[model samples]
Target chain A: MPGYRSEHIVSSYEEELTQIAQHISRMGGLAEQAVASAVQALLKLDHDLAKQVVAGDKALDALHRGLDEMAVSIIARRQPMASDLRMIVTSIHIASDLERVGDMAKQVARRALQIEGLSLNPRFYNGVKHLSDLILRQLKGALDAYATRNAAEAIAICNGDDEVDALHTSLFRELLTYMMEDPRTISQCTNLLFCAKSLERVGDHATNIAEAAYYLETGKQLSGDVEELQRVQHKI
Target chain B: MPGYRSEHIVSSYEEELTQIAQHISRMGGLAEQAVASAVQALLKLDHDLAKQVVAGDKALDALHRGLDEMAVSIIARRQPMASDLRMIVTSIHIASDLERVGDMAKQVARRALQIEGLSLNPRFYNGVKHLSDLILRQLKGALDAYATRNAAEAIAICNGDDEVDALHTSLFRELLTYMMEDPRTISQCTNLLFCAKSLERVGDHATNIAEAAYYLETGKQLSGDVEELQRVQHKI
Candidate 1:
């Protein structure tokens, strides 16, 4: 009787979990596209493309809200406990971070619309582009960690956020000098600076998601077992 | 015996909810002060004040993270069902937004540190300062809505975010002209722009919290309700 009840319950729960994971993956894909387009819009001064990014952000926002509704329904209907409940709850937090990341992408695109066709130093754009790329990679890695239930990979990604933060600081100072030297470049420089900040924030949200994934896979928190994770992460 | 079990559970849940509310209020107070000091730091170009603002932000960040951990534990241990779960989860989202609001305040302070004794147009600083004030008020109103279980008030506060956005856009355009005209004004103007954007974003995060509160109280989402909130916000 115990075996029968447990089998039926777990099978139904797994079905819903699969559906939820698919939705999250869909949302993540959209977020990545938004970030890339935001950077492209900035470099090209493409207002049309920028507008598209902003408009698409509404969809991301809706997806986040919709996913939360679904997760709540799952919790209510399924009565998830222990690790199962953690997974669903973690999705809710991930949704919030993803929505904010979408907003950041929108902010960058809006700034692009404001300062169009200005010649920025190639190195400057390159730096911002690199930051975006790194953030995108971290986001992908976090999603993979979720799929595989790999807490070690997730913890490693969270620690990588410090690198993103350092890159942001370096880029901020570089942009500051550009505006400091030439008044004409100030508007464009400020916009790009904000764009870099936005990307840095996206990296942070990714780290948050990674942390959530780790919490879901393991009943422990990385914050509590930092030393353990640090040692294990290095070996991995 | 059934009635006694129910009563004991209800009272215990009430006690935890009360504690959560108190902690959020305390965090809100710190957030209000952070925004205020960051603005003052920019207006006065006081690096020491800015440094203090930065330090204060770290504490605010820690408080936000701590509150989130507490809320999570409450939900996990208490196993809040239905609307109770939603409310706790919403708190987690609100804490993250508040933490980022603290980060933006630190960003403003960091900009202040870069510029020494340089004063910009009082009009510009006043606009940003007023915007921050409005956002703080909105955050307070939203939190009240949460504590009191008032959906309409939360909706109203969420709508107030538009005014802040409009002010930021106007300030950005005006500041651009000033920077474009004078090289020496670029650094100060850039800092002012950062403050303005930070205030605008703070308002946005406040609205997000209001939305979460509304969802928790009513268990109904007025999708794209922000549009309507903006229309009714004038009365507030």
Candidate 2:
């Protein structure tokens, strides 16, 4: 065990990069679980399940602290620069986005309890599920890119944000129709809207992760014009 | 002007660090202005001003790009290690928090439009304004700590977060009463609740900057058992 501990210590510069990447992968796993729990809670309207998802938030928060600690330790011990520095800084940002993703999931679970008895359009549920899946995939892809330091994969994931945004807009319009059709559906529809917004926000966090990955690989920005993109696609 | 360009070309490692610091300071200044403008629009109920603030989100978004560029450039050129690496990574997180601070200000402005005619309990407004001031001071103090490498100031700023949390709880309870007092206030009251939540979040971000500063100075987490503290405070 003593020998194992010493071997685990990074003796060379390259090993330090490997260590940071490992921590980021662990963080990704925690984020994936948080998102899964959030969707599960929404689908079943299960209060117990929702609370379990909320409880997972503590773990996710802990993940950020651990990642940050590992990062600071790496910087102190390794004296990394250039791409290595980018990786550490990017990990820090991605950790924050993941934590926020956990928060958004909790918000969805809160809405689930309020909308338990209320009817939701099957179409709306399906759209949200699809959006959640897309966000999950995007996050997975971004992490993969970070692990491999693959700029191409990172850019691909960044582009995937558009599809998520489109789904969110369509979901918004469909829900608005439901609210307008029946005033009695107002509260439930409103709650659902917030849930959809939460999912959309998860997509945004994924996009942020992707951007970080891209920067880590290239040390340059991708697009650098989120506003222009927004203007062009006003639906965002 | 020619002399300045010559100096730039001949700039030493320390000069680059100073240059990055100055740029971050400028970004922080812009972020501060954005928050002030957002709050001004809210207090004055100026929709046009609010719209302007919303539009200016692009500029804040652009600042993220600028900060990343500066950080990467510094890392590439200086190859800073240990405490200096912590400083650079800390700047990256601070930039992100300031960007979110800008977004929260925009959210406050949006809430103002929805609650145009409603009279908020003056106490609630005062509570929020007080919290906002505390966050502003915290941000300022955190930056000062970063500049001076002062761990004590950073710790003091972190302690101030508790005051903001207490105020948030009081505001939440007061808003709940307003919602219960009359259903008519529900919609507008909810908007105000979001505004208050946003301000509370700003305090949280400021606290994060302080923690980063502490890490830079001490090379160890000054605060004890983050997970335990998170549980006790229910920060998650």
Clashes of each: 0, 0
DockQ, all candidates in order:
0.49, 0.24
Q: Model 1: how far is B169 from its true place, Å? A: 2.5
TM-scores for every candidate against the unseen true structure: 0.88, 0.75
lDDT of 1 by residue, B11-95 (tens): 9889988787787777777877888888888877888989998988868767876776676677667767777778777777777
TM-score of chain B of 2: 0.85
lDDT of 2: 0.76
Q: What's the interface RMS deviation of candidate 1?
A: 2.6
B60-167: candidate 2 lDDT, tens digit per residue: 778877887787677666567766777777787778887887887888877777667777678877777777777788778877887788877887788788888898
Candidate 2: where are CA atoms >4 Å away?
A1-15, A42-55, A58-63, A69-88, A106-130, A145-156, A159-197, A217-219, A225-236, B1-11, B110-124, B169-190, B222-236
| lDDT per residue as tens, model 1, A1-236 | 99999999889889998888888888888988999999989887899999999999989988988898888788767766656777777777787777878988998999888895777578887888788888999988888888788987898798888889999988988887888787677767887878887899899888888887888887666666768767865874
Which pairs clash (backbone N, Cα, C closer than 3 Å) in model 1?
none
